[model samples]
Target: MLLNHNQSSLSFHSELYSFVPEDHILRRVHDLVDFSFINDLVKESYCVYYGRPANEPELLFRLLFLQFLYNLSDERVIEDSQYNLAYKWFLGLNPEDSLPDSSQLSRFRVHRLGANRVEKVLEHIVKQCVEKGLIQSKALIIDSTHTLANAAKGKPLDVLKKAANRLLKGVKKQYSSLYKKLPMFPKLEGADEEKAKQLLQYLVELRNLLEDKLPDAEGSLLEKINTVKQIIEDERLLTNKGIASAVDPDARFGRKSNSRTFYGFKNHIAMTEEEIITAIHVTPGNEDDGKQLQTLVNKTREQQITIDEVFADTAYSRKENLTFLQTDEIKASIPLNPAVYGTREDDKFQYDKENDEVICPAGHTSIRKAKTGRTGTGTNPCLTFYFDTNICKQCPFKDGCYNNTKEKTYSISIKSEEHIHQMAYLDSDEYLQRKGLRSNIEHKNAELKNAHRMTRAKYRGQFGMRIQAFLTAFVVNVKRMIKLEMAHSE
Candidate 1:
């Protein structure tokens, strides 16, 4: 067969595709990140898996890096790989090979990027940043943001019960239809019947009560009660579906915004002066930020890095936390709550250094109560002071001193001697020099939120959200490393 070819359509090319050099900044970043170190840390024997043996492992790894570096969604990443030459070069993709599907990317994220893997990758990035002189390991700013989970806005118990009853009625109709088709169908009676009836009845009652109580319930009480009722109804709904979970529960709610209570987790991050993410934590949504700080700090310590100072907001300013930081040889620079510092009532209780006693406003010195106490890890020694009941009761400022209580309260408190010492150290010019560097992490936070789109998490569940956060931090560190390298080249 003879065919006439159009010269314009059949034009010959010198090469399969013209190659462009990788960006200098991206190349420098690749050198600084140390992919092997990250692989060793994040890629576990059970966690790592390959679908097609021909697929390059490095390419997959780089895909995760891109997630944070560019803050691209899974679909966007696929589109970029197909259309954008820069993204193609970054992922080390050849000109002929087609980009991976979005679903494959999603599966890879879920099956391979578990909590431990994400943490390990983050630690490696932080270590690299420290080695490159990009991150200051000694000083750190720790903060947590609430990541909303993928759960629905739960309805009140009464409303949910009504809905469940409606569902049950539909299920019964289907069951009856099936029973008619099969003459020998098992009877849907006994415990199952009683359970169904009881659940339906309770739901109806709950719905009625909620409608009545909603108008009268004051402040947050109504919302709280409504949430509680919704949780109960949800549990019942799940039970009807013959489902149970030892881990995932309806009680789990997002911490990001209480208004958007969802089933997921919280992400806590510790950032260094060089904008490297030193540590990250993914916990249940209901977990308190105050409880996670010490654990995160401990984890950072385990990396063989000494933290000199820990900066946080008022949530971490409790006496227990202050004492913990002092004992750990780490300085905690948390601001006092306005109520605690602004009020002059506490000024009366002055510390008497000579006697280790607390002097009340009435010129009465209180003696020490306990010398030691036990914390989460071990015993902690502390000095406590208390005022005499007789003196406190007859004082003219007794109401201000004792909250108008007849008990004439005796309080036991741990005086942070090390905290006072640290405070003195912080007040020095040299310490102030280091403390001034803490503001850098704020800019880093802003970059992650605004530039990297970390202001809101893209994934649902604690594990997925954490992976996203880790990737964001990893990308931030890489960018910092790239900038540092460029500065050095200059």
Candidate 2:
């Protein structure tokens, strides 16, 4: 239950905030930003007439703001807020007011402002900047950064054993009777593959037993059961990149470059040239960066920011993305991905955009076309056009052109008119100038990792990573808003 009042009641020691400095960052943040919306944002998570009156959502949210702002742990943030006058003032607490336990921070993050609501935290702050006329840039720079998983990557057998142990541990802690009724883990002596299979079968039986005994299990117990189910269902657990760690099943192996790799997740972000982030989308490490462009753009537009230009690297230069930008009339400063637009090596084959077909030098048009190869896997997919082999067989120029095979085909790397136009724009002075704007996002990524502890996952799983990401973004945006407002005054 939420209280229908603010928590900033005056106290006998209220004057302690005077020494917190007139221009303290927290004081400026308190004065400039309105955090009252948090109460409404998380209102649905609480019961109106059940249980004890809950801690004020706004106050709890302020603790999260302080946590990400200073990169402090939940315990540290709560401990500091207990006595720090500025923190107390920023949280709308009178001096000497008691703080909710540090554990409440995790509860609030998971139950109150969950993944569905965390995005709103970033969105709300961005809308505030827009409302204040501080985010005036028409260009949105986009990029992605990596965060290492909290759990270490493990082999399939090790992962299976770890998951089994955790489920048993949770059941033992929460339901000791159920623990005895559950199947005991068996010892096996065999090859790793055989051992993994045995462990997997054991987990399958254990899950079945739990389902029968606890039909309505929820909370951490439910999560453990679900994790076991995922592990059991993954057919390629031994052969492919599936479930590296039972602790973090959602994280995957992603390549940072041709030779470098990391085990974790990705934070796809869109920001204004003003250096304020407008949108953030977190995905598994191996997820494609280009696919998130549309989502980021839509989220940024949702904040009422007029976006006329977008800046990104070659990773975002897919033909589909370019077409979307063309349809929306948004200027794209992204460089062409060489895999999408390779050199026109063979002048004999010309592409016809309007017909969406390629013409051979002999004036014969392709009959059917098919795309080959997986996208976003550091591979070049080709749009191959098949021709009537009879036509090629009878052509006078068939000597060296058509190999005497069962079929005749000509292939061109995916070449769209939007890509052609973008390629042309890539050489212009304006494109080069606007391209430099994307570098600031790299610095923003650095700040998130270096200054805000976003370099590694603080908690396990994607939801935890997302919670960390949005809260971190929220803190940086508020700081950026302060700087922008101050500059406008100067």
Candidate 3:
């Protein structure tokens, strides 16, 4: 039955206007996330204490969560929330209320929930997952991707020299015009006009020197001088770009495909079998995955979670990483680079597992000669092998075996005793299952890049980028937790 016109002016506060009504997904998020946990982890003292006192502590936090969940910049979030009904409903905001201004959000981010606070939030979520038995910490997949910084390309020396010359000429003309207007301008009491003249003269001299020497300077010295000259002439220092991020110094330039390069910091995450992130590290974009493996493993250990196996690619297959993982009883299922195995010159080369030797195609056995050791790189001892020179000299496969004039020597580095064992396990069904689990971490990366819009950070500088990364990770964990809770309830 349709209601009569205007419903006879008998409208009450209908449930229709009560957006979300505790049944929406966002409402479910409010239920799954223990606000007390976030409060405990992120201290109130860090936030703005003097702002309009609000009884709802969740207001500030929800704003941050919205940034990550939607991957919107601070300004964009405020703009959208002010006009968007869905956003207001999602954030538990009433229709009458508008979002906080961009400055307020920025201040809140910089002061209250900074990078450290965001990390604590992420840790708390991980802790919740751990307690819920949703994270199987025994197996982990570790990887890193480069993030580009917001720095600009440096200017050329010739351009700087030309610009400096133009500026010096203009300054001279301006000084002449001012002096003409006031005949005693130079004589003004306590006036540093002389100092200004001296500085200008020095600048002119310096510009002349630069113009003369720029063509002769070689290597990085030339680059350094040119950069300085550009800064002086342009009144602007060199930066990757104006976008300051707070994460790492060595932001790397990375290519995701044939044409796109991501400029920022590398985000390293170790995901467990249950697809929960066990550990996360925001490092310089240039940091290698192999170098970070041990540190991440240690961090996982710090959480009181034992990492029994690590799945990664060839990049983390360095000897040092393997040795460290082995000592910690962590199995690393890193794929071997086919190049490392070397190609068989002839079909006769066979590897011997029992005697730890290699049999040459010419029927000559290559025996272990000396155990060479490498420090700093890894604790693994490299076993050197040499074929009998007498046998090699007359062998039918001599040409194929010996590239050098001397006796043929073949060396293989055994990083761990467990390498052979793990290699065997890598072929087993259990290892395959772990590999399957490892593939899921890429989905998390995709979510960050595609869904969360983390591919290019809006902020510039290491610290800013770190804060952004932490917030993004925190949002991901919250979303996962909320989904898990909903599934459990169902």
Candidate 4:
């Protein structure tokens, strides 16, 4: 049933203050947060004199915020608003007020506040937290968790079949002559695997024939052809039954670890030890966590928060990342990948930077030393040190040190100052003490998944996931701020 959103016809009489508890969570949050700033944050999103009569901007935002705060679905949020007294009071509505349409929230996110604008909402709220002293940006904990896409592990052939049929209708509309020449769109729904494969190949043939006529086709049309190309033409498409989503092509197969895998995106987050989220960045499931460390820290900095220390798991360790953190004076609590180094005994070798020589395992030193793989810009370059083969070949423990190969010599080479700092940090008590704080982000990630609906993504594609992620961070941060406010009030 369609909801009647006509505000003029609704009754306005209600004693909501008497109905709600003095210390209600939502009520306290409502009192603590000055949502009036939201008007300015979203002012440009609204047109002064266009479109039909719309719901109030504050009303839309409050209801949308409630979704992640309570982990309610679109239909569930609207339904709860009608019966839930707290929700009614939060929205400033009387008991008999007409609820906004459920679908309207979806439309509002896509049209009114897109991914970019919603990001602004999260940042603005986080800035408020910073100003109120609820969260400090001196140290940040970073982590990534997988959110399953709104798609299934459907067979690649079945995925291609849908894309092909959608393209068939388009070709019939745009180029009738070519459409007639192509084979008729085959029916493959619920068909046997062999039958589906045959039909899929036929569609591929038709698409190839059309490529000569219109080489620049895109959108759903181009997606349809690529769907087939990814399945047949690509060698590594899905040999192990790996398949990308047909609806949300941006989502890829991601793994929790070597043992577990899920098809969706990774939500990389930065938070303080107080468990308050500062920023969020979502990437395809298979994206490397280390690559996004700087991006996440930069996001927090954009809100005027300074990140002096970073805590993350081993996945976020890279030579470049360690160099970046050390150079910026931000202490990194990330453990370097042992694979980045040589054998256990080889770690005993020390560097003498002054003479540009490496002391070998048997007290022998390399005569020739060369710098390899310099990182960062000039004036502050971090150079990697490599020793010559002549000194390494004559070592008593050469078999154990060099692993009997020319490549192993370079692989085991000492990475100047950056590696030294990382090793010293690993041996320090501060790394052990601060390393526990990294788990704070894991708890935060769990809250997003277990309490919030981040276990499975709601909206599709990168833009859609971005909208959901920013809103999730926004809702979580608000909750954290209120909790901190209550604690401080006590």
Query: What ordering of candidates by lDDT runs from best to worst?
Result: 2, 4, 3, 1
Q: What is the lDDT of residue 149 in candidate 2?
A: 97
Give me the candidate number with maximum lDDT.
2
Best by TM-score: 2
TM-score of each: 0.63, 0.86, 0.66, 0.76
Clashes of each: 1, 0, 31, 0
lDDT of 2 by residue, 250-361 (tens): 8989989999999999999999999999999999899989999999999999889999999999888877888889899999999886555644555577888899988888
Q: What lDDT score belongs to each candidate, Candidate 1 first?
A: 0.58, 0.89, 0.61, 0.75
For the record, the alpha-carbon RMSD of candidate 2 to the native fold, in angstroms, is: 5.7
TM-score of 3: 0.66
TM-score of 2: 0.86
Off by over 4 Å in 3: 1-17, 21-23, 40-57, 89-93, 153-249, 254-263, 304-306, 336-373, 379-410
User: lDDT tens digits, residues 155-229, model 4?
Assistant: 656566666666787788777887888877665556466665676577567767878777998765676666555
Per-residue error for 22 in candidate 3, Å, reads 5.1
The candidates, ranked best first by TM-score, are 2, 4, 3, 1
Model 3: lDDT equals 0.61
Report the C-alpha lDDT of model 1 over 338-425, residue by residue, as the tens digit: 4332223545566666776667777887744555456653223345555677677678876656764544323334434544564565
RMSD of each: 11.4, 5.7, 11.9, 6.3
In candidate 2, list every pair of residues with a backbone clash.
none
